[model samples]
Target: MFRVLHRAGQSHDLTYVVVVIGVVVVHVVLVLVLVIVVVVVAVIGGVEVVLVLVIVVVVVVVVVVVVVVAAEAASAPVPIVLTTVTFLFGERTWR
Candidate 1:
């Protein structure tokens, strides 16, 4: 009976160790997965920021071009009679 009890106690200790090892493994895997997910999210956010910056730069360039073109057109001279005739008809008819 004594020997049997000793054997049972030994087995119980081994079971506890196995359970602790399993828990530790699960915890480590979870931490690794979390790290990967965070890295992916950061990379995606960085790419999004870059894309937005590119779009903003393009819009600014287009706005500048439009402003410059409008200023040039405003500064150009037009004969009053020619302007009136063209407005009544069209540039295609004048050509």
Candidate 2:
């Protein structure tokens, strides 16, 4: 996670990139949902599409918020260590 942040920070435009990408993704999802809802409404003329669109919009917003939060937190350094241990066992008879 920190690796990604480090790379982004190196570019000296991490904040701008995150904002731009977030906006683009949100817009794309919003437009796609609107188009789908319109098509469904036209074909079925049912009110259920409104509920679906609302749910999709909420989900999109939540997803974007989560991504932004995660990315922002990733800017901090994280310590990770790996170690290998060998265990020796005496030979024994099975009961």
Candidate 3:
């Protein structure tokens, strides 16, 4: 009976080197992907913050203007009273 004999003296250094290189490449790729994701998230967050600030500023300005206009209107005398007085007294006498 003839039996095939396998050699057990093979050095696994090449295999180890290949595996190490592959691991390094994969790690580099993952790190690059993570950096890109972080940068994108930061940029989006910055834009959102700026947009919110702008909206807040606009709202504040609109409210201030509305309040000022309302105060002015409330403090002033009635237009109808002035008009009636002017009509009764005549323009020259009132002036």
50 Cα displacement, candidate 1 (Å) = 16
lDDT of 3 by residue, 12-47 (tens): 334333433443454467567555655675577776
TM-score: which candidate is best? 2
* Candidate 3 wrongly placed segments (more than 4 Å): 1-12, 46-95
lDDT score of residue 2 within candidate 2: 37
lDDT string, candidate 2, 22-46, tens digits: 5456558767876776677757856
Clashing pairs in 1: none
Q: After superposition, how far is residue 26 of candidate 1 from its true place, in Å?
A: 1.0
The lDDT values for all models are 0.50, 0.51, 0.46
Once superposed on the true structure, which residue ranges of model 1 sit more than 4 Å away at CA?
Answer: 1-12, 46-95
Predictions ranked by TM-score, top down? 2, 1, 3
Q: Residue 68 in model 3: shift from native, Å?
A: 67
Clashing pairs in 3: none
In order of appearance, the predictions have TM-scores of 0.35, 0.37, 0.34
